[model samples]
Target: MAKIDKSKELDITIPEEFALRDEVRFLKSEDIKLFRLLRESMNKIEPAYVATYPPSECGIATFTKDVVTSVAKYTPFSKPIVVAVRREHEIEPYERIVRFQIYKEQRESYLEAARFLNNSHADIVSVQHEYGIYGGPDGEYILDFLEALEKPAVATLHTVLQNPSPNQKRIVQEIIRLCDVSIVMVRVGRQILLDVYGADPQKVTVIPHGVPNVHRVPAARVKRALGMADNAIISTFGLINRGKGIEYVIQAMPKIVERHPTAIYLVLGETHPGVRKYEGETYRNMLIELVAQLGMEKHVRFNNRFLSLDELVRYLCATDVYVTPYLNKDQITSGTLAYALGCGKAIVSTPYLYAEEVLADGRGLLVDFASPDSIADAIIRILDDPELKESLEAAAYRYGRRAAWFNVAVDYLGLFHRVLNRRRLAKELAESAQSTGKSASK
Candidate 1:
């Protein structure tokens, strides 16, 4: 770690830093609690006013809520504010933290929301970016919001496509340019932003997806509580849709059930709102019918409800094997996968970009995409070999402990502190330069 020189010119360019715009490194370097206290005593990083999306049923909404909670743990004085986005036809109740709302299809709504934040005491803006959640072509309306924002901002991009369309390329590039700092869950996302979107590397920070800061519990204990002590729970969770490739997992269940009679597959989650609005429950019905046709109705279960954090965590704790059969090969992040890993389950996933990187080094098993046989074989391998399963569980648990939300918050606040410091230094430099010019004239 490079130390800052206090004697350096305060009115000129700030000194270069070995670790800037990130706190993950800081947490890893020293004791998190002690270092945070030390920094607070030396120079208190005040509680920043952050405006972001409020909690909802969607992935991005839930993500924003969790982040706000973790950030609040450090900044107890002023909790982050919310600028929740509402779908055109949806009218869900929100918490009081939601100071403003942006209607998805209304162009002017974005401008108004931005202005609302600008007028508030918000020191910074936090964006939970996703193409589907925002309005306009390729979610270009977010550009308007970011453009109108007057405060320092950081955006956490949920999706990073390797081969994005021209419109998507434009929107993401603009987002990177507008924000003070950009965060990605994986290094793969950072590379795509640089090589594909031509973003500034220095502005991009890799903060692994934040998981609940909970320790691994005994699987048997949770299974017994759920009244499935005799069964091996194979679970997949998230907003279910065609993109989830759940049918393939169900198709693989017959083979798995034949080999291990106690193995039961659990598809946990309600249909995605976007999918439900247009297609209804057509896709979910298809999977249910397939289960019947295979005569494996008893072997599979569907919890057709949007689970709360507590319910979701309870099931996750009981899970023996977690699977993500998503078809999209380009997906850069999966909250479901992160939670599964955090719970220390033996994960069996398709070789999606996020899975490939995180599940590397023998942490989890990966099979061919959309291949039921491959999926079955991998699940069986884990079930059949106790040592392999234990190793994967151990590795996943270790990584989960490191990537927990509290540690991730350390990185977030670290980056926030850096931005604030830079702004202060720049203001001083400008004032000093103006004073020198006046003296010369006299």
Candidate 2:
């Protein structure tokens, strides 16, 4: 197998003997041989991604890295090149996979990124779209990058608002217009794109957010390792912010503790970077105060740091039940929720868009938003009913098999091939038209 060097351009050469044989055989079967040659060439083309990549400490950045790595490992695609998005000129160290950087506020950076992809061996560009990651109002600055790109582009939307503000709606619409295809992780997001943004249904694809492949382990064993063997552990993990509605979960905890006296709610993860910069641990402090006020300090624990994937998986495996008490009704994607579902923990969540879609069909229980009593009731129901809890976990795990990172990577590669094939056909048609026009004129 030929290795694709990260520091150099992709090598798309075929073996000389094979090429000679194909050329000789092409006299008899030109169409079949050409199709096979084109297919082989398409398989060799590398894809470039534009996203906030790690060590940037953003979820979308982490996601982009995971998908690119998985695609490279599982598919015939060459090593992916990243055009990393930077925040306000702050340069974070990046791995060699990151070939270029685009500053958020610099218009010229977007143009430079486009030119880099256009001139390089990148056959397609995948833009990981999140409004906050880009500059300008509603992240409209990304439009400049898209406009300058000559190659086929695919936009993977992280947030799909059901009822977007006018500017928000326009930004998304324009993004969809500029890209060859728009990808949403949930079916609801696909519907919202078509109905709310008026995007063409044909252009939208639903690829579920990928979750790490986790082997099912007994909760007792993992909890014992984490020093919580005796407790019925419930957990919520992600960057903590007020929007997480942790206060409601804390409020609900008093009831949970009263019923299951040993029930412990583990609040894992650091405060969201944006939230901490502006609010400075205000929400976390408030949650701590609320825990003390409710006299449930013994039942709540906070691991106030970003966890590595191993640590996160260990915590998830230790959990008896997982909870996501989010306040955002229209929240389109939650990496934490997907992780919990993948781990196959019995889950209780408020009916946010992503949760509603994923936890439906008896995969998990859904409760009302911002209602502590509803949350408590759902938690109590799962804790008390052993049969129900087991059923939920089994259903979630079964679904997780389909949403695993490798499978999702395969879906992405298929989409990229389709986009590339479409671009190739369009270019060939334009060239053929030009050639025919010149011959007729002569």
Clashing pairs in 2: none
**253-284 in candidate 2: lDDT tens per residue?**
98899899999999999998888999998889
Stretches of model 2 off by over 4 angstroms after superposition? 1-42, 75-77, 437-442
1-442: candidate 1 lDDT, tens digit per residue:
1233444312211123333223434653767785566556543343323233544577887778777767766653344678888876777688887777889889999998888888877777788788988889977899999899888888888899888899998888888899888999999889999999899998898999988765677777767667777888899999999999999999999899999999999999999877998999999999999999999988899999998766787788888899999999999999999988888889999999999999999999999999999999999999899899899999998998888887887888888888877878998999999999999999
Supply the TM-score for candidate 2.
Answer: 0.89
- The candidate scoring highest on lDDT is 2
Q: For model 2, what is the alpha-carbon lDDT of residue 289? A: 90
In candidate 1, stretches whose alpha carbon ends up further than 4 angstroms from where it belongs are 1-55
- Estimate TM-scores for all models: 0.88, 0.89
